[model samples]
Target: MNETIIRPNPSIVYMIFQLKTNQPSSKLIYSIGPNGVFPDTQGMLQQHSDAISTVIDYSQGETSEVSYLKLRRSHGVINMTSWSILMIMGYIIARHFKKWDPIWFYLHASIQTISFVAGTAGILIGYALSKKVDANVNNHKNIAIIILVLGILQVFAIILRPKPESKLRKYWNWYHHYIGRILIIFAIANTIYGLSLAKEGSKWFLAYGISIAILVIITIILEVRMWIVARRKTQSTNNSSHPQSLEFAYQT
Candidate 1:
């Protein structure tokens, strides 16, 4: 029987499965936590080699030297997924539901602000990882850049929004709302692309795929609800104006 070995950086979990059997082996290892066998202070390098040594033998060795290269690579994917989700569905939902208090807007703003910072780090790590891995640059990286740009624009509109009673207030609101929605849509697209870029066997990537689908469905529902509300408002306005029109007719 052939034996396989895998070593993954810390903070990342990797599983190996036999393609012929379509089943994961009984032995599973993580790069972090008590089960994590690799030692690089913080799970920098996960290595897979021929299974010459037993699991017990491998687990006994300790090598805790921190490696910058491996740590950066491992951190990028996690941060990118987290920030992308926040900038898209998280903040947008806050905007949609926060009608009663100013705190919702503040919360939305704060989350996106943190997401932007995280996103910046993710992008830098992406650039470095791209050089090392055969990532789908056109499909994943390009789309991500588009999302980052739109996110930045949305944040800018948020920061420069006019006061509530200002003459430009309505326009500012429109800009803020529309741009945020656009950012959400782009973020969703980028997330799907990122999922494709992740390795096929990665459970984390599969979970992300499911989450993206759910977010997309939720966004559609929200849009339909907004449309219904707008239509009702229009109909109400028309009904209210009918009496005025009748009064004008009598005057004429």
Candidate 2:
């Protein structure tokens, strides 16, 4: 008969066996380091010992802390990307294609719906991973909750949108835009926090930085163009009214 004691760590499993034979109890301990061979003592043991060691190594390797972290990181990345695309890119597209009317609206709505679904799934996965890892990321969790609530509210707002001719349409537009802007800002902040927790490399930051910079630049350009167009339209309208004024003055 043999009593086995297993000690598990982030990267390795240490197994100690105490065998009860005709002689006094003999103790054998073997530590299985990452990508290392089994202890010399393991070779001296019976076939059963070899089988046990193999099982321990395989199990530990599969469920290592590194593997869990990778899984969590993937979830975070997906959530961040989805939210960014929908909130930032989709908003820009909707504004840019406003002249296309119903087409832009449909595109915006579809993107937002997909983003919400992906973000919800990501949050659920993160919660499960946090519990498994016993993580204490209260700020990240709180921000995520806020984002989810705002997203749900946005969806409902769209569903209950008033007709363009209705007086309430103006109020609905204001509420929708303000809430969306807040949600996007908080979502980006939370995503950065999550990246920090994941201990990602500099490349991830660089990628996101570039993306945000491009979005900002494009938005600025579009805004300036819109302003110029509006100004020209106003000038044209004023010039057309000048002829009517001159005719009335001449008759007087």
Candidate 3:
């Protein structure tokens, strides 16, 4: 049987075929031109056919290209979903559930932990996939590394968090919040890049886009409501502070 392999960039094409029925040797014929077509050379073909070839045995447990592609797709899904939950839902819980106090903290921590684990698993899978394919996706790889590092730092910061009344608590909070925001930004960008590379279609992009939009809307509404409540409390406190006005109103 013969196999044709197409390299993505530079568009090189290779055709591999067995030389003899009794031998395990194979020969490779490659072409470098547009649309897998190039000038045919009888001398080159004869030379390759006469030379010895190395047989690649696949009877053992070797992963096929198709399986590698499937694994890559799965990795992309895991990473994208994990980061989305970590950034969107986690932020929502932290921001809107301030009244819940320690409970909100626990909930946020649990969600973040789960997402981090999933994201880490996905990154590992991606590393393996890239190795298998010998890919040179520098942008995607660099962004993923940054995100993982930020995640690890965030986790460690939580572990060593100071008490609420401690002087270092404010600095810790600033570090955690800013790092998380930057991580989320990079993660989202990397996810979009992965989606484009996979060519998974428009539906996936639409789904994520809608999810982010809804989260933004909810955040805006909650922030406005919190501001209004704070303003009302301030007005009430100011009115209570003016005892002379209160006594004059009573006399009238």
Per-residue CA lDDT of model 3 for 81-154, tens digit only, reads: 88764666787788789899899989898888888999999999999987865555778988899999999998
The number of residue pairs in model 3 that clash at the backbone is 0
Q: State the TM-score for model 3.
A: 0.73
RMSD in Å for all candidates = 11.9, 10.0, 7.5
Q: Point out where model 2 deviates above 4 Å.
A: 1-55, 58-66
Kindly list the per-residue Cα lDDT of model 1 for residues 153-238, writing each as its tens digit: 87688778788789999888887777776766666666555555553356766677677667767878887988999899999999
lDDT of 2 by residue, 51-130 (tens): 21111233343321223656687787778877774588878877787898888988888888888888889888888887
Q: Which TM-score value belongs to model 2? A: 0.74
- Per-residue lDDT value at 78 in model 3: 91
Which candidate wins on TM-score?
Answer: 2
Better structure of 2 and 3 per TM-score: 2
Which runs in model 1 stand beyond 4 Å of their true positions?
1-80, 130-146, 164-186, 200-202, 247-252
Reference-based TM-score of each model: 0.56, 0.74, 0.73
Task: State residue 248's C-alpha deviation in candidate 2, in Å.
Answer: 1.7
Candidate 1 vs candidate 2, TM-score winner: 2
For model 1, give the 10-residue run with minimal summed lDDT: 49-58
